[model samples]
Target: MSTSGKKATATALAQKYAPQIANKTVLITGVSPKSLGATFVTAIAVSSPALLILAGRNAAKVEETTKAIRAAAPHVPVRFLNLDLADRESVRKAAETVLSWEDVPSIDVLVNNACIIGSEYKLIDGCEAHFVVNYLHPFLFTNLLLPKVLAVKGRVVNVASDCHRWHHIRFSDLNFDVSVSWKISQKSAAHLHPKQNGKIYNMWQAYGQSKTANMLFSLALARRLGGRGIVTNSVHPGIIQTNAASHLDPAEIPRLIEQVELQCGLANQEITSYKTVDEGTATHVYAAFEPGLKDHNGAYLLDSHVADPLEDPVAAWGTSEADAEKLWRLSEKLLGENFEW
Candidate 1:
């Protein structure tokens, strides 16, 4: 599809599925005003949820988002919870705070929307920065809050990316310590170099793997919790220009975009194929509340509907039951605790 066509489709989906959360309590992570998470809070608040909890590493940014939501929907209840996804301790503390809310008996919707991309390589909990922050943190946080979600038959919406189609998880060297590199060849397939001299880490590859993990997590969670009435799904929120890309070098962004487009079979060399923040949040909102999705748990949503994982090899890996189970076990090992579902 052309860039303009994609944008139109995104806008239409946002308008068609603007369901309100009503009396449900919703918790969303990554609410910096500059990102799509803030727009998500605004959308949920306008729907008049019972309570809206905004979480982010930056207390000030979370406060900013909360204030705006309150100002717009004064009748809707709003709260801010400080959360740093880079630190497992912070994730646990944040979960504890949510679990301690005496008045809010259940959480009806949990949006794991926070993520980082194209940042300098770092480690958290002895894992790659992107892997920990984008995948492990959410994995732990969601498991910690799973009981509350199950109590309400809640929906878990993970904001994954279509870029996940470009790469699969590197289980052997997830930390990039072996100097591996992934390049999208002209054939639109990812090729890996096990030993690339002077290239310690590839941020784009790490981002893709992290997003693939998000989809796998959703699939695994859905399978584990399906009978319990909780729903989990991952969504490609239509690439949008947001602060999530702030850490990326400006010139590199276009190059990465071009690569993704090629992988997705798009001819657009220009990286302008993106949705507005409002449009980008639509798929997750749809996944969070659309009753039609009740039976579609573990689905990867694109353009506001279930997308076929067979469309890409990396996507297939993400939706693989075996891979999901493997990732779940690895996550438990890394977190040093078994997640009892």
Candidate 2:
């Protein structure tokens, strides 16, 4: 409920505390050998946590990152866990794996730093891929491990984006089943129209919705978990080039970039809005272990400093006391009784 005398955005805080990235026992999801996720992983590699769990879907990239981390600090133990966020079971299994690791019971920090753009409204485990991978999966992943995090009273840093402001999440339509009579997936996703009249929406529309959900989740988590000594905040890691674009329609990527450039007044191919992967990773680092946030809790941070989330995401997502309560219950409902966490 208090600022803890801190004055920095997620980006600024990361820059200020660049030295703390090493040996911090951080778990960065979606990390790769050559991505912003990896860059953040490398930066924090210096902090040298007793253990660093480098996770991603690719075993090869995870191994490459694990090797790089070990080379950077021979004594620091680095482990790898392959997780497919799109699959709920994979996320749950990943939680079990991380919890079972030695020296991991008391986690120091959690960086929900995975995201994507230009991907279609495809379904993963029957939900939109962008929504599931970017928000729902991570939300479940975090709540599942929340006990471990709270046990150590650690920091939670969620990576969010400004694209959240682009569209409002249709919580009612998230399933995309009602519109298609319950048939939704790669095949149906391709045919699922997201626009009426003349416009370009659909695929990225769901993406925008998910990002907003992430921000709202961060806001809600900050409020709900702050009292537990767990400082939870979200960040916009900046628009940097990464493989997240791989799933995006290649031809449309350039067009979207061009539009964003004009709106932001940046030069064509300027890369101004985008930073190096290392730079992008800084915000997450700031959130997880920045000295400034040592006394912080329950605040949404952007770039590294505490910034208001895109408009009122909590309100947009579900601000009603009843709605928030309902969301928790709904989450539990979807997760099933097997997941006692």
Best by lDDT: 1
Each prediction's Cα lDDT score?
0.78, 0.64
RMSD values, in order shown: 5.1, 7.0
lDDT of 2 at 48: 50
lDDT by residue for model 2 over 1-341, one digit each (tens)?
11122222323434455566544567779877667777766655555556787778889988887777777667778778878887888998999988786756677788887776666546676566787888888989998788788887788877777566554454445654433333564345435665322123365556666776766666667667777787876676666667777655654665786675454344545333445566566567667776666455545555556664354222244223343444445555656633332
- In model 2, which range of ten residues has the least summed lDDT? 1-10
Please provide, for model 1 over 1-341, each residue's C-alpha lDDT reduced to its tens digit, 9 standing for 90 to 100.
Answer: 11122343323443444454678888998889857888877766766678988888888888888888888689988888889999889999999998998997899999999999877778776788989989999999999998889888889998899778656777766776564335433122213444332155767778888999999999899899988998889988876778888766665667777776576455644556557777777776778877878789888887666786455323577788898998999899888899777
lDDT of 1: 0.78
- Which residue ranges in model 1 land beyond 4 Å of their true spot? 1-20, 179-199, 249-252, 259-272, 310-314
lDDT of 1 at 48: 68
TM-score of 1: 0.86
TM-score of 2: 0.76
Q: Residue 180 deviation, candidate 1, in Å?
A: 6.5
